[model samples]
Target: MEAPPLERKLAAILAADVEGYSRLMNGDEEQTLATLTSHRTIVDALIENAHGQIFGTAGDSVLAEFPSIVHAFNSAVAIQQAMWRANQELPEDRRMNFRIGINVGDVLVKNGDIFGDGVNIAARLEGLADVGGICVSRGVRDHLRDRVDATFEDLGEHSIKNIARPLRVFRVIFDPEGDPAIDLAASPVESPETSSFVEQSLSQDRDSDDEGHRVELAFWESVQEGDDPAEYLLYLERFPNGQFVELANARLESGGTGEHDPGIELAFWETVREAGNSEMLEAYLAKYPQGQFSDLANIMLGELRGS
Candidate 1:
């Protein structure tokens, strides 16, 4: 008998997993399984009805593929709504909620299983989603615009693991009562209260940017004084997204000499290393292929590959 040939398809992939599955299982394994069964039954029925194929399932997660992004988004919303209704009668502790992430991309299908970064990203975005909420990749978000009765909060670009590019993320907010009138083309979501949380995050970005520029300048100065490449990388971490990423990279390549200025380089490298593990790394790299400290970044690339 001949083996089955591999299948390939352009699919809108949806991945969902129970939030706090371990806690639920620890609370009551049997009951947790029961609730999972009930929830999965509803989700499975809805997906099938929407013409989606269940590519795979683990203990508390499901991966499905749909031909249309719209169908995938609608099915996800329906699942959430149904699950919400089902949980209403249950006690708070007994309620099981899920986070969902969807993306539209090409996937490899082999032996009835789907594999690739497309699927991996969906799973990661699902983790980023709020409990009982849906988050989607930019591709899916762009596709749903002006068509769905939903509001989206931009999570900005992310550097997800195992995925080559940075993905723009958006959270889908459903009213449950009904779709609210929302402007899809409006600017990204701002904090409703502009609380300290928002301010702090913004402040950090500004500070980092400023510090990064300073470090880039200092890096050249140090190179003039004969600093070591690895030592300089430490300082660069401070301003990973710093304005001098290009200059720093060029200096590293040319082996410029300077006094060791560790602070800025360290800060910059820390950020770059983190970016390598981010959902936005791919996007960042695309824009900065010959980025600052490109040589040292190899370490991060290795780490990410291992991870």
Candidate 2:
């Protein structure tokens, strides 16, 4: 009665979505839909020609599985270039650009549909990419390194929902004229460091705390800012029983606020300048218990008590 179990295989998955689909539809629904339909037609054909299969598609997104990393990368480049050429004739406001993300991992295929952390990570990476740009997982990058004629920039590791480990990322830069220049393999990218505020706080803590604890705090701050939380999680795996392990776990649970958000930052500044109250500080501390700006939270709380 039940369907057969899906087959599992190692595949390079490419996820792509239109960057501003909603905006385009809102501006001109009829034309936008027409363009999307035409674009999909072209893309579907290209994918088939490149030895890839289109297993899924949503409103403005597509998911394809390729047997080879090189084929996946080549298909993606072809799709982007074709779309770019098509958009050239359209008005700037009428253009529909896409963002793509690729990952190579084992996935389950059922009824031609793919499912796994591999698919989820690929979609999330697509969200992180710029319009008309491509972001690929480290696995995909490494697989395609020898075959592609594109340069890749390390974007560091990132955490993705439903994935147990951080996925390192690289942005592919397509050069129409120049040959690909391979750089000697380097160490993985580290997390970004906190600004002066965190540094000053750590400096003060250093004078009073044990050297080991100071080092731990430094590492924690780096993880918070420098690298993607997903990547930082990978670090934790390596140092499973390390000091600050509990703290790291807590931050991961809380989803530390490190990524840029103008709205949240503005609200935080407003709370400090206007309320100057413990209620505000408590709220922030609760939301970001081990936040890189925890010292700032302490200072605000102190001011609230007139200390």
Candidate 2, residues 172-225, lDDT tens digits: the string is: 999522311211011112344644566666887755555554454456556755
Q: Report the alpha-carbon TM-score of model 1 versus the true structure.
A: 0.57
The count of backbone overlaps in candidate 1 is: 44
Q: lDDT at 272 for candidate 2?
A: 37
Candidate 1 Cα errors over 4 Å, as ranges = 1-4, 177-307
Which 10-residue span in candidate 1 carries the lowest summed lDDT? 179-188
lDDT of 1 by residue, 1-307 (tens): 9888987778999999998899999999867776676567567767875778897788999999988898789888877876776676567998989899998887988887998878888898899999899999888888888998888999998888877778899999886544212211122235577666787779858767656545555554454345467754755676576544554664576574312333333334444444334322333343344433332233235435655
Query: Deviation in angstroms for 27 in model 1?
Result: 1.0
RMSD of each: 22.3, 23.7
What overall lDDT goes with each candidate model? 0.69, 0.69
TM per candidate comes to 0.57, 0.56
